[model samples]
Target: MNPERTSAGPILITGASGQLGAALVKGAQAAGLAHRAVQRPAFDFDNPASIAQICAETSPSLIINAAAWTAVDAAETNQDAAWRANRDGPATLAAYAAEQHIPLIHISTDYVFDGSKGAPYIESDQVAPLGVYGASKEAGERAVLSTGAASMVLRTAWVFSAGRANFARTMIEAGRKRPELRVVADQRGTPTAAPDLAAAILRIVALIQRTGWQPHYGGIFHATNQGATTWHGFATEIFAQAARHGETAPTIVPITTQDWPTPVRRPADSRLDGQKLAAVFGITLPDWRDATRRVIADMLTQPASAP
Candidate 1:
């Protein structure tokens, strides 16, 4: 089917309850785009049968797969669940997309890389996932790309939004409760705003609708905000901005990654380059700091006193 108009058919957005999915639904609604956002019992990666059920019900002209098992540390123990969500489910979706001749946009992660590159990662860079979550997502990327469907794997990093349980929210909540907070300083990656990523996805949908799906449009694309920062830096900025709105600014202590150990080793530097996204789709996300400022403002509805 030809992508003549974005509104010509319903756009299917999975993971509707998630941060990015919520943002995509809001963006689509604000843009007046016909779309159906779904999650959980209605459309779950854990329940593979739901995939075809929802697809048939929505009859989506374009599909955006945002549903996935995103708990990083938990994935270590839940390997089967992670693979089912990240790899098998997406593979099934890709196969269906290929069969239906539908265009698909699959959301991916920066974790696919081991983060040893020291510099930013481009779309073509070699993938060496350090954990189960990353490896499963990497497998999903391979599945999507191999399907030969008009699919675009948009890999993003450190996604956060005002409406979800993300780093920013965790920092803000921790900052209010604690007099001092210790944050990981060694790990580096861009903090992509869910709203910004969602808008970018919509722009891609619009572009495809306007120009129709081209042969070159079906591949991986890196889509993160323009800059990078460590978790410590990000937490500091969050408090700095929140302080302006009368929220307490806690003392942030920068600690090494080892100080804050986890079940899996996180990427020391997982920054993704957006040059290809700009060159191809003429799309780019806003700066991390600026996006942080906006999210902080949105999150600080009523400033809470320090504990």
Candidate 2:
């Protein structure tokens, strides 16, 4: 490891197989940073022993946690699994980081906010999650902070990438099969591109290693693409971009949240304010539309059964 790098040991990135996790691994390699990307069985969130085993094996200088129980609807029925992945798992990782005096970068979600505020939420906004998934993630945030380790919690929304089964790919596949699709228009938030987020995270990591951990670095911050849009709006754009890539476009109908019933309640408007990220780290993701277009373009180049 380079002495000028953040840690003398390699950076350990959890959730190495997920969308964002894969992106981070790519970004780290592109930046020529030494990193160890580990996922389940070896670093399974449900198995706390896996967490300790991996940390001990790597002896990482820094850790970036991208692991979580991300199935929103399933979380309602599988609360125990959700808690294990989103809350207890992260709590275990944070505790271990604290014990080793390693700085941690943990990923969070915008669902922590109830969305009743009717405005973009900031770092200090009151969090009132409506379902098990959101509540569990919020609990993990609190757990990480309570450990008093040098940590940064990034809360993002609507993440997608060409590498995983995400919204953009789902819409594309659905459009290819159906002539029309109904999407929720009442729920609104920024659509973040996984690669863009991964890039921003790596930049932060380099800054921390170069400058050392600063007093202002250990806190929560909103990190997403530049703007917000409803699920309907996002789907429409996805099909529009898909059309430009020679894929068939579907008729997307806007529907209210009530039109689509699910096991858990989602926030109507969970747009997060990302100004703090720009102010503190001088980092901001690309505009949502641009990021969406890039992801769609990348997806179009892949085979139909890429995921």
List residue ranges in candidate 1 displaced over 4 A.
1-7, 302-307
Clashes of 2: 0
Q: Which whole-number lDDT from 0 to 100 does residue 161 have in model 2?
A: 97
Please estimate how well model 2 matches the true structure, expressed as its whole-model Cα lDDT.
Answer: 0.91
Report the lDDT tens digits of candidate 2 across residue range 187-229.
9999999999999999999998888888788899999999899
**Candidate 1, after superposition: displacement of residue 104 in Å?**
0.5
Q: Ten-residue segment with the worst summed lDDT in candidate 2?
A: 1-10
Model 2 spans > 4 angstroms off? 1-5, 304-307
C-alpha lDDT values of all predictions:
0.90, 0.91
- Per-residue lDDT tens digits of candidate 1, residues 1-307? 5542334579999999999999999999999998999999899888878998998888788899999999999999999999999999999898888887788899999999999999999999999999999999999999998997889999999999887799999998887789999999999999999999999999999888777888778899999998999999999999999988888899999999999989999999999999999999888889999999998888776345232
How many pairs of residues in model 1 come into backbone collision?
0
